[model samples]
Target: MLVVSTGDLMMFGISAVALIVLAYVIQKTRLGRALRAVSFDRDTAQLMGIDSTRIIQLAFVISGILAGIAGVFLGIKYTLYPTLGSLVVKGFIASVIGGLGSLTGAVIGALLLGILETLLLAALGSGYSTIAVFAVMLVFLLIRPQGIAGSNVQEKA
Candidate 1:
């Protein structure tokens, strides 16, 4: 925990993003192309002699690495308590408000959440921060369930 300073947070953010990008590139490689073929149509991939299990393993590994790094940052930014990361409902709200399962939506949602929370806390009080964020999330949900960017994510995408 002591090692997770602000500098570490900055480093982690940069490195993790770089790694994820690299992983994406690797996924686009020959092996990655094979994996994509498998994901798009498993029966076709298998008929074409592609190993579906390995592709699934690689996909899970890539996602796991990214999620682990994000969890680490969460731990560093907050406390060591078991419930520390769990209390971050705004992040969840942001993810949902941005459009479910859409990466761009999640990012935009996070930015909106952070800005809104900051402004509300300044105008009202810290106690109303979560409330404000949640209120915005609800409004967005009612107004546009697809999010500000629209429902861009398809089940197969």
Candidate 2:
């Protein structure tokens, strides 16, 4: 059976729009700036009059909402299964590839991963696609452990 359908395309469009909106909110809103400040340093943000706890709570709520949306979409696309939670590996890989904490990186990484997976599936079959993806990720980590959008920093031990 074909996996791609009109419904899937519609869902993909909706997801894309949602992601774009989220990225914009994270990049251009006051809450986003506060979140960034908190992420950079909670103590400093607190000193600057930002409520770190509130920001953290808001972040958790936003994360939960997004996760719920993703879960619903996944259920609709692939149906509920015992191993559904394991599918998060793709998101983890994409996040790693794009850059651990960068919104733009995550979006780019996911898009690139999706394209790569589709190409690999067509060329090497489904069995080998995951292997190739992981192999590529390993090579990427070996060469650029900071990820595509992550900046290199020297940490003092």
Candidate 3:
């Protein structure tokens, strides 16, 4: 049987709320618009007087802050070790599975990966479950490299 603690529930709630707030900030703010523009095309954003350099800097700062917060949350939930950073591979896999640049896609991919991993672990064992997750990611790469929510974007010359 599976058991969940209040700490786990609180963590889930905090994570969900954080994601929602981030989505809102990305979708509905002037900073968000500038960020999207700069990310899409730095040259064009600069040409349009959007201060691409500043936006890029801000982006990095924001990412660093988020990463730090995530690290703290992770430490709260699990033991810290030198090898703990290796688990970031799962985040990479989830992002790729959902589509690289899409936040919603990443969330969906994470949930799907978690569900698949949990089911496999329950049925089989940890060894096979890890292999199966990798296999699933391989299939996604081969079949739909753009990911579930990613659209093919043509680069300008």
Which of 1 and 3 is the better model by TM-score? 3
Of 2 and 3, the candidate ahead on TM-score is 3
- Indicate the TM-score of model 1: 0.67
TM-score of 2: 0.90
- Residue-wise C-alpha lDDT for candidate 3, range 29-141, written one tens digit per residue: 99999998988888889999998888889999988977887888899999998989877988988988999889989999999999998899999899898899899999999
Q: Give TM-scores for every candidate, taking all chains together and pairing residue i with residue i.
A: 0.67, 0.90, 0.94
Model 1 Cα lDDT, one tens digit per residue, 72-121: 77666666887675456766888878887455677788788778877898
lDDT of 2 by residue, 103-151 (tens): 8888888999999999999999999998999998998799988789977
Task: Name the 10 consecutive residues with the lowest summed lDDT in model 2.
Answer: 148-157
Better of 1 and 2 by TM-score: 2
Query: Candidate 3 — worst ten consecutive residues by lDDT sum?
Result: 148-157
Q: lDDT scores for all predictions?
A: 0.74, 0.88, 0.89
Q: What is the lDDT of residue 146 in candidate 2?
A: 75
| Candidate 1 regions with alpha-carbon error over 4 angstroms | 1-16, 19-54, 150-157
All candidates in order of lDDT, best leading: 3, 2, 1
lDDT comparison, 2 vs 3, better candidate = 3
